[model samples]
Target: MKPLLATLFVVWLSACGAPEPATPMTQAEAVSIEEAWIRETPPGAKVSAGYMRLVNAADAPARLIGATLAEAARAEIHTMFMQDGMMRMRQLENGLEIPARGQAALKVGGDHLMLMGLNTALTSGAQLSLQLQFADGSSTNISVPVKPAMGAADSHAHH
Candidate 1:
């Protein structure tokens, strides 16, 4: 039929033209991040913290293996716990995970990202750039907003 020949000719022309741009797929794309934010640091402070909620849409779990922020010289995945009636914090050697079809949150007084050795002060209403690495070997860049302190933010200040 003329219509069939026309469709075939169109397909042949498209195939002969420039190929579509190839973009490598990232396994980490199955996980989505939301509510990402960092706490504003006080003057002369060398450290700050950040949090986010992750939702995994994949059938397998997704691991957040590392993070980095240009504002800080170094970044670490950390957790807070009560020890001997004193609040203490430690780095998570293995990072964090979002269960399959579930969610995870890095929140205050809980699992968080510690940005240390700050080269500059973080003020409220400022925007920060953060990069997150996953166990699946994907690195995702996230823009985080510096949020003002909440009234309930009373806790040990980072050193």
Candidate 2:
């Protein structure tokens, strides 16, 4: 009888007020960006590419919908593939997807971020910031360093 009374009292207290709502995870909080770098552009160059490793730590998949840079008029997600015995690059109209508990690579000669219409030139050893927007409408800003265009091959080789 006492145990039943205690259980009823607990239920009554719980019914007195809705349980505090669980805080939702924002898109930016669910994903982490790693190893971000942008290739240096030559003088008067209007475009350059950036690469990064996107790690999705959440249970659900995350999509990289867009990116923005103050130094460029616009930024876009792009991919390069073999076409007709030649390499062709195209913009990803629907953006890029990172699988749940998996990762996506924006490496050279592959899927990458393209910064077009550069109003300012990017030089080696310089740094810039870009905002990464996700499909969930949450965005994260990351600081990217500029590296010499010719110093390396696949960066993953070093690690």
Q: What C-alpha lDDT do the candidate models reach, one value each?
A: 0.86, 0.86
Cα lDDT of candidate 1 equals: 0.86
List the candidates' TM-scores in order. Answer: 0.81, 0.81
Kindly report which residue stretches of model 2 are placed more than 4 angstroms away from their true locations once superposed.
1-21, 150-159
Per-residue C-alpha lDDT of model 1 across residues 47-112, encoded as one tens digit per residue: 888989999887788889898899999999988888889788998999898898899999887898
